[model samples]
Target: MSEGGSVKRSRCFPAALLAVTALGAFNAAAQEPPLIRFGRGFAAEEQVWLMSARPELTPNQGKKYQLKQILFQANPERFQAFLAGELDGGTAPGLAVIFARAQGVDMKIVASVCLEAAGREWFSTTYMVKDDGPVRSAKDLKGGTVGVVGIKTATDLWARAGLLNASVVPDKDAKIFPMGFPGMGDAVRTGKINAGTFVEPFYSAEMARGGLRKLFTAVEAVGYDHELLDIWFGEKFLKAHPDTVRAFLADYVAVTKYYLANTAQAKRDLHKAGFVRTPLEIYLKNADWKRDPAARVDVASLDKLSKFMLEKLQWLEKPVDVRQMVDESYLPRQ
Candidate 1:
């Protein structure tokens, strides 16, 4: 009888352990918050905010949403991922989104990511050349090649516009060569390209390398305050999870405010993220962290960009309805 009782107790112990394991899993599942995958660009400012803000904004009982940031090397990749449903939402250039919509990709601009504010130079793409290189101005780039991260991207368009502002006809006088952002500084440094367009970390990195100077920034080329990047969401994601989207925007706004307020912490986060190689002060001085907490999408600015893409660049076949493409309802309520 003692031997039978010992075997029975061992079997009961195994069953009890299994019951506990299953119950723990069930409780965890119940507590897991809804996740929204966000595709972000490879900019230092954005990365800093993403690193610092995600923790503060998560697990809100009132919001009920969690954010998962997905990094993309370029806007095209991010846009493609959003189209394929790999990303719930992400940022894309206003022109890129407009062009994608013209091709039937159903997406909406939920908020502004980066913008050029009047009397203040927010983060803008910069065109750079060797400090002592022969090219002194955009006109000097005539008959030579300029490296751009991608064709028809904001960087590319901005470079072209800079050249045009200097009375140099792009593609006619100066040519654009596609190169990765990581390689652009080297390309210009080694004389592989006459000039290269760089954004944030790359711009800061190249500047820190001690042999480059800015020919012009996007703000100078555009001649007015414009929205450089915008937060967007696919139609399917919006339809399935509107509340989650709203919650995310609310959290995102709070995160942006936190980043703007605590720039020193943001620089440390950027360094930790492997975006900055130089001292924290180098990044702090070079990068501009000026995002509004409201995340407002500037319709007039977007419309102007659309018009520029359609008329000046001839990249878009026609103008897109900037108002229709923007959905302001998802922005965080004040």
Candidate 2:
């Protein structure tokens, strides 16, 4: 009887171990979270927030979701990657997003990354020239060449508006030479271009170098309040992963708050992330991380950009429905 009982217990032990192993596998599968691929362009305030948000989005952390950020050299490249299904979402200049939507890219403007409002001079793109150069003002750019990061982007639009305000026709009075933001200052300094546009970190670095002067800023050019950059998610991603999208926005808002509250720390983080090489003091002095905590999309600003793109620049064949392009449903509840 004892021998029979021992054999019976041995058989039951194997069965129990199998059940436990299967349960463990099931639990592990359940604990695994969905992965999100997000694309960002050049180092900017938004990218800083994104980098800060990354650590908090781990599988066992805030959102319990995994985030992967893909970097692109320019906004157009970022948007193109999103359209090609290489990215789940991306950051782009608001104008680029609008133009892409007009061209039938199924994407939605989920949040505003950066905005230029009246009295908010914190974040802006500056038109810079040699401090000792003959170009004293925007009007001086007439018949001169201006370097821009891209055509029809926020920088291009702002540069054109500044020149136009000074009675200089963008195409006629000034020619736009496309170049990288990092090279813009050197171009202006060496006369490769008459003036160049520099944003944020690059702007700060150039200012610290002490040989350039700002001719105008984007905020000064487009005076009324507007979004400079917007956060967009592919429509298919939104539809397929609504929960993940909501989680991402929540984490993004939290991270943005962290950025605003601890700006000094954020700047250090940006340097560590290889976004900027400038000293902290220089970055702090010239970089502005102003953003609305609610991450609300400004419809009025969107309308303004669309009108400028379609009517003024003639960059778009037709106006995009700004109202349709924005979907605020994903924003974390107030």
Candidate 3:
């Protein structure tokens, strides 16, 4: 699980110098830079696209890096490894960035890895129950059981916030059953839990299982066009390989453009990655993937997200100034 815990929406912070200290062993071993290994979490289109190009980007490419696929279930520990400088750097959720910073991890957003072509939306949190059970809407679950990917996860956080805003508290109105991302959907279907909060393929999967309904979607609550995710790297890695990082970014933009332009092929590859389902057209059309020239760090957006996480006391301390965390000198200005 991530380092931080959930807090009330009104939580505040007085700020601190740094609650986490650097790992000394990492600094000493910095002389022999390790190979580049990509970290993956969840089966979003971004991971599918990235996985296809792994060889050229890693040890197979004769580069001092090796790309390994880690399940989203292991992202937290993998992210901690990147922060400790044991691994080069990799992709993570936007919320992971917030939690990593709270742990004093030295990392930065490299580029917009994925954007929502379909836009932010209240994706259905699949809810299931006995054939005779009766519950619907965020309001219907009072004193019921709700399944989720994890506590303090972005999905869980927003679900709670949205329910409260709707006047339904999870603990008071319902109990949250946390499970790994992979198992949550099936668990819901088997009647082991009531509803499950998930993203992408799993959300679609739950619906396919039948008898499940969309309670609420994250996008509906946060606005449809919200930038809910990103990819990032360690600051040290960026400083060590500026030219390489830039080349990777250029390729990333090109690759994503390719993915969008030839979405047919992209879907084929994505489906092979287990990130999508059959009928390529539906996945292509339904996927919220998007890209932009301005996909570089949006300081304003980052600031808002950072402050929101801090003010919500999602971390051990307040977030540092957004400027301190994001350095856009590498990205060609839009």
Candidate 4:
């Protein structure tokens, strides 16, 4: 009887040890921090690259969540990456955010990245006309073509709304053309297009080139200063790794606060982050968009903008729940 029991115990001991080893391997794999692949547009938007310059701001960045930032030209391309599941999160305009949700993209507005406030703090988007050209107002664009970074984008929406507000009908009084920001100024100067949408670094360049005049800014169309673009995260990613995202948001808030407080220094480092190809002096002279250091978004403004998308612009077939699309819980406590 002793020999039989001893043999049975030896056999079960090996099985128990093997199970313990397998469980340890599984736990180790689970302990690996989540990798967050994020994207951004221009030098001013999101500015996630700044985090790399100041690692101390993101203590949990490499420890809890890995960040990969992609530079995109516009929000549409960023959303394309989101659609292909290539990006976990990135900067997206309110129009694109609504369009994505309406089309079942499953994204949430995590925080405010950049916003155009009422008044001349522009550091925002600028709509420019030929400097020496006869076109001065939205009314002057009648029967002319207007260039936008992309159709159905913030630039397009603003241009349309701005023209309409001036009592000029878009696509009727002025035709909308899709083009890149860099080419817009040249196109306007060469007369291929009537006007172009301008953003930082590029806007300064155009102004220096000596032939573009400001027609209007984003505030003219939105009725007041509003969010131009915001940080968005895939709903799936947020669910799969909530704690990691929280850490990332905390880092984001820190860096943004740092950037807002030290605008000049932040712009100086813009080129270091692969954000600016232009000279640092120009970027220093211009400020980027304004955002809450706490990363709070204007829900009322977004809700109103979504309504405009549905009614005025006919950009949406149905209404989107802006409030429901915003997830502020992931933001670190201020």
> Which candidate leads in TM-score?
4
- Cα lDDT of model 4 by residue, 1-334, tens digit: 9999999999999999999999999998888889888887765663477877667777888789888888786676788888898999988787789888989888999888878886556576889998789898888888888899888888888899889988889977789999987788889989999988998879888788787899988887678778777888999999998998899989889898888888787777766665667877776786567878888888888988899899998888899999999999999876
Stretches of candidate 3 exceeding 4 Å from the true structure:
1-35, 45-48, 54-72, 115-133, 270-286, 297-301, 312-316
Clashing pairs in 2: 143-173
lDDT of each model, Cα atoms only? 0.78, 0.79, 0.58, 0.83
TM-score of 2: 0.88
Candidate 3 global TM-score: 0.73
- lDDT of each residue in 183-239, candidate 1, tens digit only: 998899899999988876667777767899988877788887777778898888888
Which of the two candidates, 1 or 3, achieves a greater lDDT against the reference? 1
Given candidate 2, what's the lDDT at residue 106?
92
Clashing pairs in 1: none
Distance from true location, Cα of 189 in model 3, Å: 3.7
Encode model 2's per-residue lDDT on 172-269: one tens digit a residue: 87898888887988899899899999877787777777899988878788777788778888898899888888877877777777777777776777
- lDDT of each residue in 102-175, candidate 3, tens digit only: 67878877666554233343233333443345656667677667776667666665566556656776677777
Worst 10 residues of 3 by lDDT: 12-21
Models 1 onward score TM values of: 0.84, 0.88, 0.73, 0.89
lDDT of 2 at 254: 76
Between candidates 3 and 4, the lDDT winner: 4
